[model samples]
Target: MNAKIVDQHVECYVRSLLPEHTGLLKVLEQFAKLHNVPIIHPEIAQYMSVLLEIAKPTRILEIGTAIGYSASVFASHMKRGHIDTIELNAIMAEKARETFEDLNKSVPEVSLSIHLGDAKDVIKTLEGPYDMIFIDAAKGHYQTFFETAYDLLSKNGIIVSDNVLYKGMVATDDYIVKRKITIVKRMRKYLEFITTHPNLETTVLTMGDGLAISYKKGILNE
Candidate 1:
């Protein structure tokens, strides 16, 4: 992310840098770091930007809104849509509010709303039809998030899940007993179930800690 100051600094300083920029990208990143917002890696954020641009979803439901860095990225690329972000951490929710307040005044093209509660519970209150769903919250709740996303997404919609690899821990032997093994294994199981499902077609790509993209066809949920 040498192209962007946020990338360079977050990498050098926090080591959890994500692909972002200024003008718009930087403004959000600054607020995130300023509030100690836990954001995604730079490379992943860049990739996510492209994904959002390509999909251009009218309604996007983001499971996690840590300081709003990624949400900002999506907001910047979403030419005509708004973002619905869920942040369970009160500190993070408050930080994201600051970031949104700053953006709402300057960047009028995008609007952001926050759901303050657990993603799964908050998701139930949401009435659907989100064209895009981003699952990036707790590592252990991936499976449940999948089920919820399926129920919320519109027809021919797409869902993106992050951090499936957990820093390559999923590949280790079972006997090793990794701290996050159970969750990681469950994530893998969820991935397999989604990829093999008849209604949804999924392709897990090896991009920046692994991202699983699932595309759902038609409306079959009852």
Candidate 2:
């Protein structure tokens, strides 16, 4: 399965067809690279842009805001939407706030606010029914995130979980390292739960690291 997934060369070729980032986005991408922050790849961002273009969600709930790269991307593409992103690390949250301000200067149609705290705790306090819920935080807590997302998501809404495959380790135990066994195990469980849940319909895409896109079972054609 991993062999069938896009290779580095193919991924690069696909990315070449996408437009180049400019302004703050370019800077954020560079900062993420320098700081070793785990931001989505450009191709993944493009993939998400296409989804947002179609969904046109008015309100988005983001579980992770690692310097706000993905949140800013969500805002920039959503045209008119509000994003509430949670970040546990104070320093990263501050940087994300700064990134939001920078993004606002250009994409003024979108609004973003950073919720600083553990997402598991913070999610409970949020008033939701959000159009979209994006989970990209700690791999071990994805199932918990989905539980919160299930309650918060509106009818016909979508739930997108990133790093679901964890570099394909979740697909097979052969690639799982000692340090990542727990994360891999948890991710596998989360994938199984989401894919098999009667209330949800999920498709795990091989793009980027890996993305699991799910929606309520009855809403696909609606």
Candidate 3:
């Protein structure tokens, strides 16, 4: 399952350099692995936190709240920010809510709101001008998510899409299999659109799976 730019040893070495997390995050990470829930890699989460620090986004919208790990990361990094995370699975949503509550005990200033429902439907109801939008949900619907999230993005906003490389399959057909062809094709198409879109300046980092960071063009001069 490790189809990334860095080899396993290098990845491990890099991760070793990161500070240890002894909080609920460590517990969540362990639980997610045991249950096979796809959570962002620790290095990826660290990168996201760095992005949050630089952007200093006050309002963040996360499309997937899978147990609230990334949401918690975002909240902890931002000095002042509110997160609105969506999760389709009720059980996962409940667990994420609990995690947020637990995290709140320490960082009471960070605000996190969980929306339980299909992200597509939830996207329709959101009236947002969020400073940052993090998409880590259904890989197949990334294009739709980006389209819906575009209108909600504030000026100078940033959109971060995780798992864009799809295990390096999107870059080349060598790793492709019959069952995953559809997702690979869709992810490739999504990458093409984001990279070539007239209004977006997108860069795909060959990190965990891959992370696509897109900035709405023309926001800097304004």
Candidate 4:
């Protein structure tokens, strides 16, 4: 009866109907549930997988690596890409390393890289020019992350940001969540700035929580 349960159910049914998951990804998804990792919704995972399959990017940089659920899902579909995923939580990072190692048994082709630290500090040290950048780290840090995202992104790279809607709080009046106002305001500001930024073309899709897909548009301009 709850909205969160409804969302979860819908995502489950959609994943059930999807036709293309290979063996490792299916098992990896199951593991996500058993451990209660709170990876992206299944519909969102499908979106992420489809995008990876289509883009066929050579390199991906993910700012969050929570238990490596999404990272494994992404790896299973990435035929020849390298992934550099970061996690600020040391325990999660260690567990993620184990997950990636376990996945290596069946899905051995992917180059899964791990970075454990605050992304802002780690991003600078990372060898970038990544074709895909997925931001799912701290919510309040989205804007700070976005600023560097543009710089590290390749000429025609893509950026996918998760949870921009903040459980539908951004649209409500200020009194709704007066206590945590700072994050809501910052999220709205980031969304607004990203939508209007000249170098990128972005659309906020409402599939799950909300996904902000931004594509660098310099090639289209030229």
lDDT of 4 by residue, 73-98 (tens): 78877887789998999988998898
* Candidate 1 lDDT over residue span 1-222, tens digit each: 012223345446544454436665677667556766667766678777788878888789999998877887787777777789999989888878888887776667888999999998888888888999998999888888878767788888999888766555554554324465678688778777878888888888665566788889774565
List the candidates' TM-scores in order: 0.83, 0.94, 0.95, 0.86
Rank by TM-score, descending? 3, 2, 4, 1
- For candidate 1, give the lDDT of residue 41: 64
User: Which of the predicted structures, 2 or 4, would earn the higher TM-score when compared with the native?
Assistant: 2
* Cα lDDT tens digits for candidate 3, 135-167: 999998999998887889887789999999887
Per-candidate clashes come to 6, 0, 0, 0
lDDT of 2: 0.89
C-alpha RMSD values across all candidates: 5.6, 2.7, 2.0, 3.2
Best by TM-score: 3
TM for candidate 4 is 0.86
> Looking at model 4, how many pairs of residues clash?
0
lDDT of 2 at 36: 99
Task: Superpose all Cα atoms of candidate 3 onto the true structure and report the RMSD in Å to 1 decimal.
Answer: 2.0
* Residue-wise C-alpha lDDT for candidate 2, range 1-222, written one tens digit per residue: 243246889888998899998888899999999999999878889999999999899999999999999998898887797999999999999999999888888889888989999999999999988999999999999999888768888887899999888887888776777888899888999999999987788999998878999987554432
Taking all chains together, the TM-score of candidate 3 against the true structure is 0.95
Stretches off by above 4 angstroms in model 1 are: 1-20, 27-37, 174-177, 219-222
